[model samples]
Target: MSDDLTKAGCCAGTAREATDHPYEDRARGVPPADAVTQADLRTRLTEIPGGIFEMGTRKSTYPDDLDSPVRKVKLDPFLISPTTVTNAEYARFVEATGYRTVAEAEGWSVVFHLLLPDAAAHPHHPPGLPWWRRVEGAFWAAPEGPGSHWRDRADHPVTQVAWYDALAYCTWAGLRLPTEAEWERAARGGLARKKFPWGNRLEPEGRHAMNVWQGDFPRHNTADDGFVGTAPVDAYQSNGYGLYNTTGNVWEWVADRYGPRPAPGRLPERNPTGPCDGLQRIQRGGSFLCHVSYCDRYHVHSRTRNDPDSSTSNAGLRVAADL
Candidate 1:
């Protein structure tokens, strides 16, 4: 992979795995057959009225990302959580079901090199992406590996979760991961053909709207956005729909698989779920690790994909339900 692709992938891009990894077989997961939903789950969700909105971009920055040829997408009304699942929220799920995350089961997950207290101790790096380090014991609870704890970051979006893990959480809650079309609709916040949830300008009125890389990516972050890592899930201004941190705090797993996108004229008119079968699942928005210089995927229309079994420090989940 090229350096740009590798670096972008390190943020919201696909995960590169080695064939010899010990946990390869154990990474896959399925929702529990007896999953139950909490009665109060919908009370905290924001209702999105069904409608048609333009999807994709006419001005494409990354061609390979396939975010072009703007098309109209119609969605059914649905309810979505205002924020990505928080560390505290996920802890409740784990405690209730005694569910073990893939990272915890496999003994390791990918972590940002800068988050490591001693980067040298974890010498393994994914090929072409030295910024990503394979760290032992780096699950959602121990976000940065063994010594780090999620107690202090209870409000922050939970990370190091695989797509299947998100699915498990959704099933248990009687909710589901939002379809890629639904995600874009919620992220757009009723806007039309804009680059971001708020508007085209990134930092509207000289104020940082979301959490994203402020300085140099990978090597240095100026922390101009008041965060170096994951921000509180409720951090930054809520979009028009009252959804918080939809783009830059972390990449959120969606229901669709990476696609054989239909031609613009052939696009599905109502709630398109993308392809029925694929190896990788779609993840929308971007992460704290994204920057214009390397990975500019924080926009509402932006997207990327990774293997369903892959786990990373900058990926997370949000829930949606039929209204």
Candidate 2:
């Protein structure tokens, strides 16, 4: 489950008992789960029905850890936030709780060197990925460097928040991080074996569905999707289940600790929760910097690992709840 932040870059919804959106798994005759509406779904939480679905991939997926072998994962009904927490939302939590993020405590964080202003220079680089740079005071509020602020990005997903920080936010909000299995199932959006959340095609019929690197890797970004870095949480189309930014946004922290897939040729796992213990926790979804030519780990099944206290320009969180 160990992965490199050298690659992890970082980056909501409402309504309906999930059963209403059976269109996602209609092909397999998957019926909706019981209907129990949660009267007060925080701001924007979608109820994802419990059901069995495939996890991991069988086809080609690059930069894929490959440690998570293909398996069937069954989940119970639960409510989950469709988008990652926005800066405005996090600010509210901070104002109410006087909470300080790990990045703020450390006084520095990693930012894409390309994104930082010229004055915010740091000689350090992660070898081949020179785009990543350490900057002083580059937490979520100051994403690029000390000069940056979330004022202009109030609606964008909050970045530079570590796993411990995310857990803290969840605790304050009475929410929890989705387990790796729950995350994959939600990201799948009820579709079967598709590459991206939408389908096998990256750009269906020549239309960009989500935000990721549009041009060359690191060197350039065409911004064909109208965004170069992080886009609004709901920037693209939702999958059949109506979850936004499940893929190709920011690498989101999940509930599982880093672990290897079961031994080769093992049976399918049921409600699998990752390994007993590890230094790094799991992160799902790729970031704006993910390019097929380089990382290519932005697909639905893609995942990586990072230190629980690590924060960067590309990491964020999505909250979930039990139903």
Candidate 3:
């Protein structure tokens, strides 16, 4: 184990032995996380006066990407969280209801490669990238790997949560997950046809502005962005619209369902939800796992999807509401 893991209690069994459920045979799906109590939620609403913005990517950008089918969208004013949900905020939900996260309850959660130590020492682990481990006892509270708690990461985004879990939190908070369109609009930070929330340049200068993979990827992270794993919520500057960490840190769940076919070239100008139903839900804002060599979905218009019931160490949520 690495020194950080030791300090973070990665090898400790105190939290691990607390697991009452059996491992190996645990069902494959989101086991409930701490439930939301009536009081844990705080609501803030913003009315985005209706307007038209050029939706999707332009030809100059990564037009080949599915999410970049540039089109116009009209949206009604709505209120959304100024920042992604934090660990401190999520802790309130857990403390109030005694909710056990899927990873904690099941005894394992998938962790990224760079987050783990060398695989030869931890031989029972999966292969390929030793970083993506089914870490025993990993959860939102202990995001780095098993036994690592969220005490220092309280202000960081709450990860290792599923779409359903996000929905549950949204319900408790009297907010909802933003539709894919709404999410993209807010991520753009009111900048029309911009490649990123900040502007056309990925890094305005030689400086690293967002928390993304900086080195060889999977194997090495230079932490030039000042983050190895997740950064504090306010670690970086906010986008033009005052949204923090909107482009990186963790992938956020959106309310829209994934469509096998691209959305119609001509979409409703106003507040369009996604397809009626699909196998997966949309996820946006590429995670800390993103790198230029692999999984560069960090661009504002980029998107990916996964099973709604699935939860990974890199997944989290932000809340939105109707105006």
Candidate 4:
């Protein structure tokens, strides 16, 4: 196999036998038994054994991001998508249900600051950050502003999907969005407390192992990490559990509602879901827009939340099963 493929964990030569996780065996190339059938959709459900793990970072890890408070979390065995939902897969869902994504229905979505052409066009653009433009016609089909289409991003994670949209696709596939606990546990991939899925080292050998922004913050993206925008679904190495893009590419929506962590001492020790009624849902795995200078939420335990009705070009989802 080629070195790039091996580095990307796509070689699957001797590494397949040596590093393959048994959970991945359940749905290697087969769609879930009850998954919706579509010509272009491919589904892989991986089984994740649950256990206890630290759910947040130490103050020293990321001093500024106070949202991540270290806590112990436990999960139950569940099945999750081997990869993020791709544009092609989501297209299948839209074709079948005629579902209009939030971005499409809302008539606009948030694009990164660097993606816009003229920084001065939108006066309301985040104060100092003029790169994020509220471009009209910017939806899932057209991620890079109005005229941009999904042809080149067919294998890329389908962004601009709202919580409802993700839930719809999950239901159509006879699966469900993963609970926050399930999402984090699977992301950890059996590796206890570590900065990323692979380990504490962001780039073990000074090489970009995952798809993330490189170079200066919002002004410049060198694409040294192999892609300036979204990369292919399999563009990066899988975690210990054989799951791909768990930390980067796009933010994934989970099933649980958003709420403050239970006062550290009062948190649950077993399968804990978020609050009963909340306005926003949990989103995991930062997106391609993540940069060290701006947002470095690509870590395994890192998380963010958004209103259920909100959708952006950098948000997407993965499905999970109870069995």
Candidate 5:
């Protein structure tokens, strides 16, 4: 947490080092995979009748993320959680398996500077991303360093969970992370080429559709969406397919790997899983921190990447299963 901390390697040493902050030499450990029988998941997972859909966007918001070269993607029917994994759901996994998240194993994680209870007390800033702070003792259980806990936000989507942590939870819950194409198909909510799940308009009829930053970035939040950090999993209206918080609340980790933009003339890919040798994984949907002024990746086609062991205050996961 000190300013003198230099950039170090991540939990997955074979992968590239994290550019954000220094880390301890913790070996990447996989959580124990439990039996694949989740009765509770049967009721929570919504069936998505999959088919071919135009993936990506022609009107690319962030061209470098490769949100362009729209392609036709086909997927078989699958079941997905209506919302991101909630704190209560994750608690069950922790209590049953006694598993520890990567953030907890590393003894620290990234937290938004403003979300810190005493931002002024934390003088050091993360590299490149000055809006974030490398907070000691920040993990899924205690989100805002040591003082804050997830007890009050049990219904909210669990954050500060690394991609590996999410995979562990999915393995324990008898589920899997959705493919990037599958995620986009479900997030579209049956709409075609729309910026949002609802439509092109961010706010339809002057009503907030999802939880996103409503004010100037890294400065002030109007909380016009009724939430500054995270909202309840089902806080907003469900999408056309009865899915909630598909576009906002948290950046959801998908099953695909991160790669460069596709060639413009390449043919359609059937159930693409990104490049076979790619390292970092892809995160879709945007988080509550997303704003037009700064990180406006809340739209359906938008995406970003992070190492498998990366965890933050605004990232979480949604589970998917075979139908």
Candidate 6:
């Protein structure tokens, strides 16, 4: 991407205009298009006040593909769930609708190699990233394979859910995905634009604040954060607005399609929603697989994209509702 576009956006993941990014392909999710309406779905939500703040990072330790342009933005008051949707919550939806996620329909999803109890593979991994293994029958219900379920991690955020799957849940639960601007705003947790949700310092006085890769990437994971995979949805201290884990655990889906930020010299934004259209959708927050040595998107304000139909073990959902 050009310096102009890079200066217009922020995040560890970048969607170049002409780049052959994997996410550009058609989404593969199989959730029905119709939104479900039945139960009164409610969650522990944090009320965010209206304010002005920088939306992107001015500087980052990780390479940004020119997506870290710091820009001023204004937002209206809103309410956001403090934590992501948990497995127990998602199970309720499945039980109600007999929902078959994209992964279930596809019969396979990407699973991190280290998470598996033993070697099980068909060997279709992402180019340049071989640690991702395509395992059959890997869906939200069976995160690791037929043997794994959410019983142990019931309180943890649900994973192996595609963007379409998340929207379906939001519709059924009487919620909606937050826009990119709103996500960044809530992620800041009332702080001015900083590297992370908590503050500028990654570990305030040398303690792992959230679940992220503590050791090497794709190889040796010390798991010093007291987790080998997803942690409880409400693991750490709440942010200024009472939100948790805005920077780590799993990438949260947002409402907007992926596109470049407004070019330089544009007016300061008010509820900015990115470009008119694009191939991919926005994924805010980083995931368990992220590390400074490889993927440093663990920093708040960083953004990424994926096919709306694709699901992976590391990707999950954080729902938002209209208040």
Give the range of the ten consecutive residues with the poorest summed lDDT in model 3. Answer: 3-12
| Reference-based lDDT, each prediction | 0.82, 0.73, 0.67, 0.68, 0.79, 0.72
Q: Which ten contiguous residues of candidate 2 have the minimum total lDDT?
A: 12-21
For candidate 3, the TM-score is 0.81
Best candidate, TM-score: 1
Clashes of each: 0, 5, 9, 2, 0, 7
Put down candidate 6 lDDT per residue, 1-323, tens digits, no spaces.
Answer: 21111111222111113444232232222233233243234436677787777777776554433356688788888777888989998998788667777677667776787898765444655545567666778889889878898887999999988777887777566677788888888888878756787788989889888888888777778999998788998898878888889988988988888765765446667877777877677788888878877678877777777756667787777766556
Candidate 3: list runs displaced more than 4 Å.
Answer: 1-47, 59-65, 117-130, 261-267
- Which is superior by lDDT, 2 or 3? 2
* Best of the two (3, 5) by TM-score: 5
Query: Positional deviation of 282 in candidate 3, in angstroms?
Result: 0.9
For 71-154, candidate 2 gives per-residue lDDT tens digits of 776788877898999999888767766767766766677777567667335865554556677676778888887678998899
User: Which TM-score value belongs to model 4?
Assistant: 0.81
Per-residue lDDT for 1-323 in model 4, tens only? 11110110000000111222222232222243333362123336888986667777765344433346677877777888888889998787667666666556556665665666654664333334445555667777887566678887899988777676777676566777888888888887788878788898888788777888788876788888888777888777888898888887888889887665665666546888778875666788877777777677888877777655556667789888886
- List where candidate 1 sits over 4 angstroms from the true fold: 1-37, 266-268
Q: Per-residue CA lDDT of candidate 1, range 104-141, in tens?
A: 77677878888888898987776677788878788999
Residues 1-323 of candidate 3 have per-residue lDDT tens digits of 11112111111111122222232123222233333532234334444456778776654233333665577888887766767889998887667556565556556656665576643434333334345555666678887565578887888899888666677666545567898888888888888877788887878887676788888867788888888888877767777777877787888889987774445566555678878965567888887778878667788887777655556667788888776
After superposing candidate 4 on the true structure, give the runs of residues whose Cα lies further than 4 Å from its correct spot. 1-43, 60-68, 116-128, 265-268
Ten contiguous residues with the weakest lDDT in model 4: 5-14
State every prediction's TM-score relative to the real structure: 0.91, 0.84, 0.81, 0.81, 0.89, 0.85
Which wins on TM-score, candidate 1 or candidate 4?
Answer: 1
What stretches of model 6 exceed 4 Å from their correct place? 1-40, 60-66, 120-122, 264-267
Model 2, position 152: C-alpha lDDT score = 87
lDDT at 127, model 6? 49
Give residue 200's lDDT in candidate 3 (0 to 100): 76
